[model samples]
Target: MHARTTTITADPNRIDAGIADVRDNVMPAVSGIDGYVGLSMLCDRSSGRCIVTTAWQNEQAMAATREAVLRMREHATEEFGAETPEVREWEIAAMHRLHPAGDDSCARVTWSRVDPATIDEVLDVFRTDLIPRMDEMPGFCSLSLMLDRQTGDNSLTAVYADRPSMDASRQRAMYIRDEFRRGLHMSAIDVAEFDLVLHHLRVPELV
Candidate 1:
């Protein structure tokens, strides 16, 4: 599977309107397009940062929607009262879900980098080592890892039942993250937590 993510820094007050537009407008339009799979949106209200992602059956499918989706993306940005957005394409590397996310769920997203040549090894470690640990975390809902193979840039999003559960798992999560980073020689670029405002992404389990 392939995915595209559009990151926008919106006017904090306009977030709700932006989200509503995505849910009621953008989603319906995108769903009718060929090869459409699923869509998800994450928001950090305090920072007015939102990430909207759409998954496609393949790279070609994703590419084909670029022009068509552009107008909608621009409209979303305008609805949010945000400036230009940042966009990226990724390969769905791995996905595992213990349960579907609920309205109260939240997600922690981490962006990191690894040598492109080590991509396969990194994925192996993620599947064999990281996933099992995450599965045991309190209130875990799901996790998805997306990779930009050529650039070796990757993003991992882990969802929890609620804010409290996500908070409770922080210490252990950090420990596991540290160990994984050290073992894989991965370099962290950024990390942020957000409310999982829209969780309809229906990408199949890929682990």
Candidate 2:
């Protein structure tokens, strides 16, 4: 799968207004996407930055939806203001589902590379060695990889159970940081904390 993420800075007090605008105005096209799996908008009121994540089946499909995405951004900025948002694209390498609420849990992930490299061996190490270790962490809920089509910066997101799970098991995820370099890849440029909500379409109506 693939995803597009945007980080935009806006006035803290007006965030709720911004979020409401997106829900009312920007979500219509989301329901129309071909490979669109899900979309999430995350915010940190103190940090003044909000993140928007859209997941798709492939890079090409994500590319095809660019016009729609750009339109959403323009609509968002009109309400949130005219600041340029930091943009990043991603490819979803893997995904694991979370149990529905009132049953077990609710957290999920989407990841991509932070370093830009097209070498075959680099990807091999990521898929073979690096990603598996993420799955082994305690309370690890799910995994997904994203690669930007333009810059090639990969972002890896691992979702977990709750505050306790993320706090306790994060280091285990960090252990593989050195391995990326051992594969002659660049070190992580930056990593961000993300809160995710995952949805799957091809499922049975167990209720």
Candidate 3:
């Protein structure tokens, strides 16, 4: 599967309107396009940062919708009273679900970079080492890893049942993340937590 993410920094007060536009407008339009799979939205209300991801059956399908999505993105940006958004395309490298996310679920997202040549090895480690550990965390719901093959840029998101569970796991989560970083020689770029406001992504389990 392939995915495209649009990151927007919006006016904190207008986030609700922005989200409504995506949930009501953008989603339905994208759903009717060929090869459409699913869409998810994550929001950090305090910072007014939102990330919207749309999944497609393949790279071609994702590419084909660029123009259509461009317009929708512009509208969303306006609705949020935001600055220009940053966009990226990626391959869905791995996905695992222990349970479905609920309305109160929260997610922690980590963006990192690895040597392009080492991506396969990194993925192997993620599947064999990281996943099992994450699965055992209290309230763990799901995890998805997305990658930019040529650039070796990747993002991993782990969802928890709710804010309290997510908060309680922070220390252990940091330890595990640090361990993974050292073991794989990966460079950490950024890490943020968000309320999983929209979680309709239906990409099949891809461990």
Candidate 4:
């Protein structure tokens, strides 16, 4: 699968309204498009940072919708009164969910870089050593890893049942995160927490 993400840093107070616009307006318009699979949104209210991602069945589908998607992104930025957003495209390297998220669910995303030459080896380690350990964490909901194969850049998002559970599992989650970083010889670029703003997709499970 392929995905496109638009990241906007907007007015903190208006984040929810922006999310609503996407949920109630933008999504409905695009959900029926050819090859559209799913859409997810994440918001950090305190920082006014929001990330919206839409998934497609193939690169061609994603490419075909680029112009329309860009317009939607611009509309979102305008609605949120935010600066221009940053956009990216990626391949869905991995995805697994134990359950669907409830309203209280939250997520953490880590952006990093790995050696391009050893990407496959890194992915194997992630599946075998990291995911299983993460699954044991309390409140764990799901995890998806996205990759920019050309640049060796990657982003991983892990969902938790609720804010309290996410906070409670912090220490152990950090340990595992650090272990993964060290083992993969990866460089951490950015990490942030977000509320599960909107998740209205019937995306299939991939293990």
Candidate 5:
């Protein structure tokens, strides 16, 4: 998978409108891109910083979308003003779409600092039961499960449509966690919840 991340800072006054444009206009363009697997736009309204993330089936697909992505970026800069929004990109080795939601969203950033030797049990439970159950969650439209390609630590950030939905899914997730705790596991699984803020350099639009 080819993963790309673009971080930008939006204008404080135009933050809301910019997010709208991104949702409506920019994101749709990305949705239509070649090898487009999925993407997430994470924003911080108060700080006016935005993270535009995309996942492709491969780099070739990502290459094909460059012009389209750039066009959208240019338009965003034009609409929102380029001075304040600083845009940057990063390439990820493995990308997973934890979840895809509408406008509002939430994320569960689960990371663990565990002994690599004891990972077999955690992974077994995740694959056999937890993953499937969580995938059926309401507002759980898309997901990406990434095992540290090198470290062997199970790191995942599950995405949701909104904070409320994410919050709603927790009991079920906790139930699974409790099961894991009983399966002779050691320390390592840690989860953090984040409230998604929509920000657009121009405006956040709906697709």
Candidate 6:
């Protein structure tokens, strides 16, 4: 699967309105496009940072809808009163969920860079070491790892059942993250906490 993400840092007070516009306006328009699969959103109310991601079935489908998608993105930026949004695209490397996320679910996203030659090794460690450690944490719900293999940029999101669980996992999550970084020689780019504002994505089953 392919995905496009638009990150916006906007006025904290306007986030609710922006999210409503996405749900009521942008989502319907996106759903009408050919090959459209799903849409999700993550937001940090305190910082007014939001990331909206739309998924497609293939490269061709995503490429074919670029113009329409751009318009939708522009609309979202306008609604949020945000500056030009930072846009990115990635391959959906792996996705798994122990259960569907509920309204109270929250997530932590870690962005990092690794050597392209060692991507597989990094992912192997993630699945074997990182994920298991995460699973033991209270309120763990799901995780998805996205990659831009050519650029060695990767993003991982760990979903938790509720706010307290998400908060409580911080220390151990940080330790595992450090371990992953040292083992892979990866550099951390950004890390953020967000409410799982929307979780409509239905990725194919993990192999």
Best by lDDT: 3
Q: Please give the CA lDDT of all the candidate structures.
A: 0.95, 0.60, 0.96, 0.88, 0.59, 0.88
31-107 per-residue lDDT for model 4 (tens digits)? 97999998989999888999999999989999999887767788889888899999999999888788788899999
* Local error of candidate 1 at residue 20 (angstroms): 0.6
Q: What is the clash count of model 3?
A: 0
RMSD for all candidates, in order, please.
0.6, 5.0, 0.6, 1.1, 7.5, 1.1
Q: Taking the tens digit of each residue's C-alpha lDDT, what string does model 1 give over 1-207? A: 999999999999999999999999999999999999999999999999999999999999999999999899999999999999999999999999998999999999999999899999989998999899999998999989999999999999999999999999888988988788888888999989999999889999998
RMSD of 6: 1.1
Write candidate 2's Cα lDDT for 30-59 as tens digits.
868787766766655665667777777777
lDDT of 3 by residue, 31-117 (tens): 999999999999999999999999999999999999988889999999999999999999999999999999999999999999999
Q: Regarding TM-score, does 2 or 3 come out ahead?
A: 3
lDDT order of candidates, top first? 3, 1, 6, 4, 2, 5
Q: Give the TM-score ranking, best first.
A: 3, 1, 4, 6, 2, 5
In Å, residue 195's CA in model 1 sits off its true spot by 0.4
Error of 6 at 56 (Å): 1.3
| Per-model TM against the reference | 0.99, 0.73, 0.99, 0.97, 0.52, 0.96
Candidate 2 whole-model C-alpha lDDT, 0 to 1: 0.60
